[model samples]
Target: MVENINIRVANLQENYLIAKHLYLMWQDIGVPDESIQSNWLEITKEYIDNARHKLFYQAFIADISNTIVGSVSCKIFAGLYPNIIKPEYRKQGYIWGVYVEPDYRRQGIAKKLMEEAIAYLKSISCTKVILHASPQGKPLYSHLGFDENNEMGLDLS
Candidate 1:
């Protein structure tokens, strides 16, 4: 494990860094910059703002000796379908933006961030936590006990 790693909840002022991490994550996974909007930072910031207001959103940052190396974001999921189920049985949380710098990866930074996010979701009384993992992230998530669910998608293009 990397020594002196500090994981802490992030405030609104750090949203820009979180957005930057997310953008880097997409690029790492082969998403072309040209495919992204010119105002991506503003878009991500707006989304985080809305989620913080309308959903129980929270973000975490990983700092090693005062330098930030990673971040993760989680919140109560806003489902695509009507959420009519009882909270006790179906309150689900969503985790996203699980990112770490390439140099800091494989040193457990992402794992620590994920652990922090999981604990936060549990504290919020979430019955389940869900995340869409990238190919490189699937193994780590699986090791964390995330099972494969029946979520199928198709490309219309």
Candidate 2:
């Protein structure tokens, strides 16, 4: 078993790997393929690029035993309706895409990543943070002070 883990800002070298892993995980969890292929692709690329260009926002990676096991990304979306978040690193604050390897669940990797994400967001003067959690992630997010939102969405496409 891995003894220790590290969390830090993701670099360009790690972006593709993290994005691919997230794509697979999201697919396995039944994220609609079309959405994953299109929306997520754009969002991931934007986050990766933003992480490279912008210091105010970043994507954090979690590594265990020197292997990247999970990640949490946060960015800003300007001019979106108070609750409408942008997927292209345009949110006014941080929106995370946090995932932990299945085998590593319950080990607190995600939690640590989240804590780091929040700290980073605060450092950049973020007033709020948000994430869309799966059923499995709901408990962890709730434990971290996230609450359910009573919002509705309509696909204009």
Candidate 3:
């Protein structure tokens, strides 16, 4: 619902900007600078490299006046279930790196980015889509009809 915002599939030329957006997203979520500074660019580069060869990987960007203000990425997860299972049953889409600039928030840019990611996943026939919601982004995901799963975690540290 954001006026004049264009959402489109991101290309290799925009990987660095996507990485920047991801770094800002982590910072917004309170990740330590040391953790993000040393590795974010390299990590995102690797992901982009893999995405070039993997049909399951897709990224979307929200642009206004040629400036990217928001972004999202999705990857299809092929479950560990045996190959005997049907493909549709084994395929799931996992969304990540959803971020919007602080100045551009509340104008539905993130929502539009998510909708594009979801549509891409659906095009590949993924049976379900998933994403780990940040505290600030949980409401948007919920409004988009995402349900919480019983996933639990442990910190060995």
Q: What local lDDT does model 1 show for residue 63?
A: 96
Instruction: Please give the distance, in angstroms, between residue 45's alpha carbon in candidate 1 and its true position after superposition.
Output: 0.5
User: Clashing residue pairs in candidate 3, if any?
Assistant: none
**TM-scores of all candidate predictions against the true structure:** 0.98, 0.76, 0.91
Query: CA lDDT of 102 in candidate 3?
Result: 91
For candidate 1, the per-residue lDDT at 112 reads 92
> Whose lDDT is higher: candidate 1's or candidate 2's?
1
In candidate 1, what are the lDDT values of residues 1-157, reduced to their tens digit? 8989999999889999999999999999999999999899999999999999998999999999889999999999999999999999999999999999888999999999999999999999999999999999999999999999999999998
Computed on alpha carbons, the lDDT of every model, listed in order, comes to 0.95, 0.74, 0.86
Q: Whose lDDT is greatest here?
A: 1
Q: With candidate 3 superimposed using the best TM-score fit, by how many Å does residue 67's alpha carbon deviate from the native?
A: 1.8
Task: Give the better candidate number (2 or 3) by lDDT.
Answer: 3
Q: Identify the runs in model 3 with alpha carbons over 4 angstroms from their true place.
A: 78-84
Query: What is the full ranking by lDDT, best candidate first?
Result: 1, 3, 2
lDDT of 3 by residue, 21-71 (tens): 888888999998986658779988897778657747888999999988899
Residue 62 lDDT (model 2): 85
Candidate number with the higher TM-score (1 or 2): 1
Tell me how far the alpha carbon of residue 155 in candidate 1 is from the true structure, in angstroms, after superposition: 0.6
Kindly report which residue pairs in candidate 2 clash with one another.
76-90, 76-91, 77-90, 77-91, 77-92
Q: Write down the lDDT that model 3 would get.
A: 0.86
Give per-candidate clash totals: 0, 5, 0
